[model samples]
Target: MTKAYFILILTSFVVAGCGTTQVKRGNLGKVIEPQESRLILSTKNIVSVGDVMLRAGEYSKEGIKLETETFNLKDSQTTSVKHKQHTFIFSIPSGEYLLYSQNNEGSYYASEQPFSGLKGTKDGYGGLFVPNGSPSATEFYWNWNKAPNVLFAHQAMLLTPINGSIGKTSSALKNKNASIPSATLTYAGVASAQVRFVYKEFTADGYARPAFTQEVSLDYKPGGTYAYKSALFKVYKADSTSINFEIINPLY
Candidate 1:
């Protein structure tokens, strides 16, 4: 049998200081020969743009053994490319594997959960007010009523057996309680496919927020075939005044 591999492309606009500033950011990483008895992994142009770092690991029932490789872009002088791509190569024994990429500062990885619930209150003078029970007027002034904001956004991919035996699902999978638009799935090859998820976010006052609807497309492929699946898409939010609770495991 031929060797199998997995590739991931993560793209986003870098936002800083309360989502005020936006900059283009991208990173690419891959794992080859995942299921082969022996494999080779390689990378290129990864450290050319923005600081780049790569990591590889083998997954098994026992545990995970990880190895890391780091490349510093800050120390090196390189021009920014409009469409720069990075590549990584590795050799390993046959089995399932995971790969990750990050910036030189050490801040990027696929995570299951990204954000946490609001834990503190706001006080007068826009300072941190430590009170309870949803910011009453006595505890906070109207100007001090600080709404939540998006701090960070993260994305990750999870692979599972296609025979429905793994019992794994997408992070943005659908549920009966939620309203979702119809989705289409495209089969790319034997082990890979794409699925798209589209939905809208409504406010507490019973109005649909403008530009609140989002579609997220994800690509899936097995170790065998090269078929392309339709893109799977989902929407996530940093904060919403109308929504009381954070949407948990949006897609189950």
Candidate 2:
């Protein structure tokens, strides 16, 4: 049992506020069989991008019926809109569904706590004045019957537009603007697999102090959709330790 699990990618959570959605995935009635129910949307780019959200839903047990896809940049010769790489094909009825992404709203699709940054704000602005060494914001789980049955929710970003020099420190022009002025919104929540970080020692009734920690799951399987095949999560440490949460994704 060599499970360490100590990985913290952090810095991503300006969450839910881009505006726009017509709602479609067979209108959420869930029934798209392109060859045995498959839904994929996670370009797996690595870097260089912004403002591209694609969410789909259906996984009921009293939760997860999401629907969001609002990425626009139509061009008529030149208004500056070079956004391409969209592959969303869905076929449902096999049961269980939920997808997530919001690469521009800073990042999203948290699975029930552990995405601190809550858009971050303990005082002043943006969790310890954001800019690389992010201090907070990481609580994703935008509600999908509580989210995380996992069909997909892969967000990739690399927003760049740092135009505001000369005594510039308006907090880096507010962490982003002018189409993401100096930004970043990486996906894979927070990782370092290798057993990451897991420390448990029981026999309490003594000393204990823990703050800021979120991760309900992860180990790989961030592959592609149709509910991939693996990448699952479930880490509940209670007995008497004070660590009762962990739920990675994929596995549909």
Candidate 3:
């Protein structure tokens, strides 16, 4: 069958399923369809996290015109409240898409690892970790143990120190008490010494953040001049098994 004819038939299936089908967008800014196929382009930039843009090929009598479409990851204004920006609302149809350029800003905290949303050749639904803020903000206690020679240096946010317990924490510990060194006590006792570690409270802005971006190309047939710009995406295929993309871009 011809490309245009196939697209026509595919549109029917999409329209028929619209009533019952629900579209879900992920933090990486891509539409997630478990039993369907599509493509999305998004950035990790905090200012533009909710906005997604893609470079598409539009066939014209002169040549294939390059077009851009920007949309919010959210589907509705209500959902956009938390997301914050929604210039366009649109979806992507199933077809081969290509990633030509990718820039991954490293994670803010050394403990938190940064990731490029979609990687290599992948099929089916996927999620990308968008750094909204520090991985965590709440203060918690850890390294609960007893010390022999009680050398309690600091106090914990929760749970009072019983004897020689320390409440050293992971991230909060560093943020609050950078001057305090790990307690090195002289433990002479044998079978009854536990240590406790504490993590103090902190805010999300305590650490730095990362912003990533990637440029992708959608497959389109090379005909007519376009009148206006739109989020128009033709349904090229309907089979959920037909969608897949190869990552040819770097994440740096």
Candidate 4:
């Protein structure tokens, strides 16, 4: 058996979000949807060598509005609609980065922590799970309670890096990257309460990277469907997440 790591090119759709502030970072710049998200790379920065860490949603649910109704306890009522919309603000100066995704084959381990989508490694359904093919402009949410080892809720997006050419990164560069030490990438938004990120690294396939969980939607949709566009949770990235990951050249 052979393992294959890949960098695939895919199309993107841009959606501009109104500028806002992130709780963790305070005031940032324009809000970026999955399309507007990109990696800022340069010949100078070593720590900035990957796509922006995907931002977690302040609100767990999207495209759902509450309809206001007045119940007279005996008669009828009137109502309005209210939906929670939040923007992800980036403070980390945009630069070189690689898009990261977990959960291919839609691996949603209710008991597995990190929900790093690595259980496939043990089950032998190919390898680490992720988007087995091209992904569309859709939002992904993880019932953190359902994601094994996860204690929070999270809304994640499937995206690509601005420049995607992470073929073989030499062990020397990986060594250098290791020496550089990893820093936490952050965005900004003030969470009301009941949310925080616990950072830890997990090894899957062959690459080792930090894994963290944030609270998103408290509600879990068990039947494999969202209220809005039914994006396939099983497939996340455009490339197959299976295959052995041999770290000949490592890029984060």
Candidate 5:
């Protein structure tokens, strides 16, 4: 059987009192995955603020199935899905598609490419504020017990760059939080060799937080490469300081 490698890059940022700081960071290089099989990415002390969970589901044109398992990176075994909101996870099947997400309150927060009706705007304090594509926002409470304000957004394409020719339909932000929107593209019938997982969260106080944006490139005949970009911003309360964060894959 052939061996597959999964690459993941986890980066985080915390902004307080008008200053930014980088906390607990590392990269999981090339995790081996068995061919014609499925593997879960696991880690220890990987998430500094909250628990890192994985949710998987098959992609279709109509919609996606929410009945998926939530796996913990700490343990390589299947776990329970505790969150009531839409759980985020990446399941690749050697194809291309557009990825997007929203906040619990039914707000469109993030996307791989620039999206209309959900762009960040400057607030009264000259801070850039962006809604989570929902009426209300959700919080991602890490192990530190710090409930970091969280938002959901996704990018389009599997292992290919989104070209301008694809037109406006190439990327879009959905209002409904649970609606998982994705698109599949063909690649010479060679099958996609790898899958990339990218996500970003922006606060309401002019601060952008980075969660995890990594690539899991599968090993197949004549292996291929993928590239993409993601951006998120946050706005702080009147008496609070805000920060912004941006995560770029391949960093090239």
Candidate 6:
């Protein structure tokens, strides 16, 4: 009896203020007009060109309830900085805001729960507002994780599994005394075989533990299709010792 071994491999909330700088502005018999405060949105890492949405207040499932604006990074005015990073500048009222990011294809990549914008500096002028880190927002760093996985834009993403072990299930046997399973196409006159499947989860740092696992007995013919949970695949060949299958929806 022969056994085939098939291996398949697949892969914070903080609100702080920028230090205020005092500037002396003499108002000697002169009326000083109030200038709008600027909020600098800079990113050192981005997956692709897409719209960046910012809404007043914190993120909620029912939505912002107020006016929400989206700015496309491609169309927004940006300035080049050191290390080829881009900085997006926005003039918004002083308040808390939530940020949502999505790719051009409408796939969400990142989300920032709540950040603040201040209106005054030590100089008694419009102050520059930013996240905990100024000039570079670490929350926008999408490339932090090198693993390939889906990105959800709404809220914090859950961890996923990686380097999952392959699971096998068989239904029939030909020789009771056979020490190993056979791959000769048929077993005990049964036109069925076993196929191995794997489960995976995604994470920002790397991968997460398996969401779940269950023991199931499945029988399929050569070149047949099957579905297990959200995974769909077609069996090209299967036997007691080895099986070959193709994932129909790899991204699902």
> Where in model 6 is the C-alpha error above 4 Å?
1-211
lDDT of 1 by residue, 1-252 (tens): 323322211112222223432222223223211121211222111121111111111111112122332111112111111112321111111211121332332222121221121223222111111112211111101122233221222121112111111111112212333333222221111112343333344454445555755543345322211111221122121111111111111111
Writing each residue's lDDT as its tens digit, candidate 4 over 27-138 gives 1112211222212221111111122222121111221222211101121111111112343221111111212233423321111112233312111111111233422212
What is the per-residue lDDT of model 5 for residues 66-177, given as tens digits with 9 covering 90 to 100? Answer: 2211111111111111222322222211111121222232212112211111122111100011133322212211121212222211222112211111111221212342
Clashes of each: 39, 33, 17, 31, 31, 7
What TM-score number comes out for model 1? Answer: 0.15
The best candidate in terms of TM-score: 6
Q: In angstroms, how far off is 12's CA in candidate 1? A: 87
Clashing residue pairs in candidate 6 (N, C-alpha, C atoms within 3 angstroms): 22-122, 22-123, 23-123, 160-201, 160-202, 160-208, 161-201
Candidate 3 deviant stretches above 4 angstroms: 1-10, 16-111, 119-169, 172-252
Superposition error at 223 for model 4 (Å):
69
TM-score of every candidate:
0.15, 0.13, 0.13, 0.17, 0.13, 0.21
lDDT for 109 in candidate 4 is: 15
Q: TM-score of the candidate numbered 3?
A: 0.13
Model 6 lDDT per residue over 44-92, tens place: 2111112111111111212212332222221111111112122222222
Candidate 1 regions with alpha-carbon error over 4 angstroms: 1-192, 222-252
Quote the positional error of residue 80 for candidate 5 in Å.
55
lDDT of 3 by residue, 84-167 (tens): 221111111122121111114211111111111132311222111222332321111111132222221111121211111111
RMSD of 3: 35.7
